[model samples]
Target chain A: MTIREIGDLLDARVLCGKDLDVDVKSACGSDMMSDVLAFVKHRAALLTGLVNPQVIRTAEMMDMLCVVFVRDKTPTIDMIELAEESGIAVLATSKRMYEACGILYANGLKGNGELHG
Target chain B: MGESLAFHYEVDGGDFTSAGQASVKIKKNLRQLGVDAETIRRVSIAMYEGEINMVIHANGGNADVIVDDTGVTIILADKGPGIADTEKAMEEGYSTAPDNVRSLGFGAGMGLPNMKRYTDDMKIESVLGEGTTITMKVNF
Candidate 1:
């Protein structure tokens, strides 16, 4: 799914990279940055509730395209600036992590399983 | 690149907000050097983990990324409380970071393991009361 589609589906506010039209192959919902680093091998979108600069850094390390802040969580100005500098699109949604993941998954954005085949 | 290039940075442990600065800069450097995306990602992830570890456990450290003909090598050294058991420390889900770090989205004990998983080679050396130095390599 494209970043715009993700924002539309989740009713999220595009925090940064408003003009970005990138396509994300997968999505991972986790507050644990290590799991995202250790497991996710594809270019995916991270849906996390944890609000910190490291979230942006983790996504930057993984070369992720977008970060969807779940549970109505808002990142600090530092994080927004970091995301802008990294060219990563940021989104904030009121949906909880589970529901956010479920909505994205059901809409054809699968997980790492796509990499196997 | 025929000549080896090295980038060094001092990780400021005083501020948790600035932990991964080195990694981010390294990522940009690698990109400018025309390193492949996957290799850059791996190198960035490993270095980021090491940087975070230094800040959370070592109270800050120095990070060096050396890119040469063979590949990239990252060395992180810090003068802080050293790990008593390297074996246990390598295990996933084992962390000594304080609870406050956990609230910041890390300290779940996945740092070292993630570094090892992403890098092509990894080595850890430390003294009980002295400090720890981690060296990791990623090949092209």
Candidate 2:
């Protein structure tokens, strides 16, 4: 799905990179930045409830096209600016983590898949 | 473009919010040099984890990124209290970070392991009373 479509489905507000139309095929939801760093692969959207500059930094490092904040959490001005600087689309949704992941998954966006040993 | 290029930055342990600035800069630098995306991601993630560890534990330190034909090398040095047990520390799910850090979405005890997971090679040198230095490499 396109990033714009994901936002539409999630009823999210586009905070930055509003024009980005990157395609997102997979996503991972977690409050732990380390897990995201350890597991996520390929270019995908990151669904996280955690709010910190590191969140944006994590997305940027993974070359993620977008970061969707679950549960209506507001990102700090620093985060918005960093996302803008990194050219990553930022979205905020009132939907909780599970619901958000489910919504995206039900609509064709799926997880990166099982971890390998 | 050069055979070997080095970038250095001083991490400010005073602020948790600003911990990964050096890693961000390194990511941008590698991108500008036309490094491959996967390699860039590996190097930056490992370095970013190291940067966070330094701030959360050592109160700040120095980070250096050296890029060459074979790979990228990251050297992180800090003067914080050294890890008591390297073996245990390297194990996943082992952490000494305070509770407040976890509230900020870190201190998951995955920092060192994640660093090793993403990099091609990792070495840690620490003097309990003195400090610690970690060197990680990622091939291009």
TM-scores, each model vs. reference: 0.96, 0.96
**Candidate-wise lDDT, in order:** 0.89, 0.89
- Model 1 iRMSD vs. native: 3.2
Please compute and give the TM-score of the first chain of candidate 1 against the native first chain: 0.93
Candidate 1 residue runs with Cα over 4 Å from true position: A113-117
Q: What is the Cα-based lDDT of residue B30 in candidate 1?
A: 91
**Span of ten consecutive residues with least summed lDDT in model 2 chain A:** A108-117
DockQ of each candidate's interface versus the true one?
Answer: 0.64, 0.69
The residue ranges of model 2 lying beyond 4 angstroms of the native Cα positions read A113-117
> What tens digits encode model 2's per-residue C-alpha lDDT throughout B1-140?
55899999999999998989999999889999999987888888899999999999999999999999899999999999998899999998888999999888789999999899888899999999899999999987
Tell me how many clashing residue pairs each candidate has: 0, 0
TM-score of chain A of 2: 0.93
